[model samples]
Target: MRSMTLGLLALTLASACGRNTPRPAARADAPPCHCSHDASAPMAANQPLPDTSVFQMGVPWTDQSGRAFDLASLAGSPTVVLMFYGTCQSTCPLLVRDVKRVEAALSPAARARTRFLLVTFDPSTDTPERLSALAAEDHLDLSRWTLLRGADHDIRTFATVLGVQFSRVGPGEYTHSNLITLLDPQGVVATQLEGLQQPVEEFARRIEGYTR
Candidate 1:
């Protein structure tokens, strides 16, 4: 069953993340499905995670604060998740900035209950200390944002679950898909915003519904 779940997800992602061309900046007119869930409702607390939940990976992780972390603990709050390395010279900086824009757009009520999770593709370079330093450099609100790294295999598994393709292109460098995903309170992927430099108002609005 687990293998089947992963297989189906891989197929779904092949279409979503396989595109070589950059997806266009998100517009108000963009398809609603981009910010909507395939499931009709969030799962109840006692319910097992659906096959689509990334939290199903059950991998051990370490956060920027150097604390051991569990992915499932993120349940019960909406989370914004993305994958990137700290030192990338190209799209990573812009991707982080775009996520911040969405964060800034959320109302305090919504923002308080929301979490931002940034996991690194290059775990060897993005140690907890380095992730913390990068967070400080970006002025991330530590109370809400979490930067995480894990063992290489765990990182690969987690990336696969999120449909984020990444590869080490050179020493200290990686190429990765620019995908921002929103997980519902139950940790099921509710929607995604792809590409870079996209408008964030609609994305922010979609997230607000989950917070409330």
Candidate 2:
């Protein structure tokens, strides 16, 4: 009976060990995002929607022109902020391709009124010179797709607020989220596209909503 009891205890301990998992604490963003707004909430089901573009991060950094820029930037018109590295192997290119597609679909007047901001996460490698070259290679209009850089801390902060996720595996290589954020002229996140699988028409529609 003692031997049986010992075996049962060992089995229970093994089961408990196998079932253990490190649970993460509730994050600040975990709570449903709500504010005192007369409009509507930005959450649908379990996901966040940009009902109002009031979210802004004041983190500061520099632009491709080597001028100071910040997350709380005020664009002349509403803007679409995108994240990518010059040396990205996959998703980044797809994002740019989709943006171009959207641009092509836009009316000449709409293209003139909207803006795009590309923030580089790998700022150490993507200096102003390299960013310039990459922009040229992609035929990016500096007037529209403005490239920006930030130090690691501020860059991470900006990425977090935009919900852009990334992990560096080696030098100049990263696994990152394929996301694009639409910010209104007032500098609020109007909406965020979490994946690149959506149609360019979808992005165009989203952009129009923000422009209004």
Q: Pick the candidate with the highest lDDT.
A: 1
Give the best candidate by TM-score. Answer: 1
TM-score versus the correct structure, for each prediction: 0.78, 0.70
For each predicted model, how many residue pairs clash, with residues at least 3 apart or on different chains? 0, 0
Enumerate residue pairs that collide in model 1. Answer: none
Write the residue-wise lDDT of candidate 2 on 107-194 in tens digits.
Answer: 7776776777888989999998988888899999988778888888977877777778787888999888788776655545655666
| lDDT for each residue of candidate 1 in 1-212, tens digit (9 for 90 to 100) | 54355535655666577568344432353223322552334446776765666776789999998899898887767889989999899999999998999899999988887899999988889988999999999999999999999998998898777778888889898988899988877676767888898888876877778765
Q: After superposition, how far is residue 3 of candidate 2 from its true place, in Å?
A: 47
